[model samples]
Target: MASVRFNLRLVAQSHWRSVHRWQPKRWLWGRARCCMSSLVGRRVMLTRPASQAQGMAANLAALQAVPILLPVIEIAPLADTSELDNALFALAAYDWLILTSVNGVGAVWDRLAELKVPGLPPALKVAAIGPKTAHGLEQRGIQPDFVPSEYVAEAIYPGLGNVNGKQILLARADIARPALLRLIEQGGGRAVDIAAYRTLPAQADPTGLAELRRGVDVIAFTSPSTVHNFVRLCNGEQLRFPDLPGKPVFAVIGPITAQALADYGVKPDLVAVEYTAEGLVAALLNYFESQPLRNSL
Candidate 1:
């Protein structure tokens, strides 16, 4: 895992320099009229879940690019909430409440509301993995006690301070990695991971699949599940990702997603250093600007 992360860092450093060199009139957000010309009229396929793809689609459209929505993964509340409900009712017993994604934040809050729990206990510290998750908590009038410098789950450990003899409750996806929980346990923290939600494969959208068959300029992935589900959907339709000319450029929001693509023998064309929708768009603009020929395709 260390070696994998090290390789990802190297790739990030290489891509960061390229993304840093470009300066669009309004890189991430502003009037579409002021956006860079490189992405104008280009078709970018967004592969996030339905609920989460809107922001990225809006961002792409605002940049004057054609956004094709193709939801690959669906986020749903788990049917069996008894386990999570029990965990939330005993929230005060835990020293920390760790949320790993915006979905997790939503699930935890929904359960809390259903259970009639007003809010988190005053003494319990809260940790959010990224700005987006932290912002979700903030929307509910809760301020996180800690957010790591890096957006990844592995980066949240140092901010947690001494966890010896501490009890931590992690509200995360059913398919979440065990890295964070293992780290906490190794530090003598009693970490209980509760499934806040389930990630399921989204039924393929006919329009989106047709657009993909015709070809797209770029395809963006935000998570491993998206990458996996995309390939699954394509395979069901007898389509395969190829390396021919005019093939869609594969762009990912983070190294983990990039690694997911790599696992399927697909190397990402760009990886966002910031690991957010805005960052992904910025990287796309920068990539197209750098490779002017891609703009024509």
Candidate 2:
């Protein structure tokens, strides 16, 4: 993961190389009409869940890119959040509270609001993995004490620093990975993990599938599940991301998302430095900026 920083420029260039090898402009859209912005007239495929997709869509539109809504995942509340409620009810027992995603922050905060929990426990500090997560916590009037420099699990435990014997509460998605929990425990901290949300594959509409087949300029993936469901939606039981027409380029949010595509034998054309919404958009524009002719917008 550390080496990723040094290889980013190489990866960005490598993606351009791949794009150049393809029938020129098939992916870049030859001779696009400029709209006084870098992304004017570009077709950007947004593959995040619908609720999350709106924000990204507006961002793209701001840059004059036409956003194509192609949601491949859905977020739902857990059938039962009793466990989470119980943990929140006893916040005093914990020394720290951990949140891994914006969704988790939202879920836990929403529940606390329902229970009318106070701002936050004074002694129980909080940690969030990403900026969005921390920002979500802030929106609820609870400031997170720490947020990992990097978004992945590998960065969390270390970021917490000297958590020996500390009680930590980890509120996350129902299908959240256990790696973070194990790491905290290994560091001599007692961690309690609760599920605040569930991410399920959303049914893809046939119209959306048909548009995908017709090809768009770029397909943006924000998470691993989006990549998986994208393949499932396009390939069905055959279970493979189709050889999408129109020479679409894959722009991922970060390394985790890039890795997800790699698992399915797909190489992302570009990966963001920061694992946040702003970072994703900036990275995509940077990719286009690398090519002078493509920069005319």
* Candidate closest to the true structure, highest lDDT: 1
- The estimated TM-scores of all candidates read 0.88, 0.81
Question: 289, model 2: CA deviation in Å?
Answer: 2.6
Instruction: Give lDDT: candidate 1, residue 201.
Output: 95
Residues 1-297, model 2: lDDT tens digits: 423322232344344335322322232232233434566667788888877888668777777787888788888888887898899999989888888888888888788889998756566677777666765765665655666667786677876788898888888877777888888888898988888899889887666666676667789998888888888787773433646766677899888889889998888999987676667776777787654323211
Off by over 4 Å in 1: 1-27, 30-35, 242-245, 293-297
- Please tell me which predicted candidate would have the highest TM-score against the true structure: 1
Tens digit per residue, CA lDDT, model 1, 48-130: 88778887788787778889998989999999999999999999899999999999999999999999997787778788876
Q: Can you give the lDDT of residue 103 in candidate 1? A: 94
With a 3 Å backbone cut-off (N, CA, C), the pairs that clash in candidate 1 are none
RMSD per model, one decimal:
8.2, 10.2
Q: What is the clash count for each candidate, in the order shown?
A: 0, 0
Worst 10 residues of 2 by lDDT: 23-32
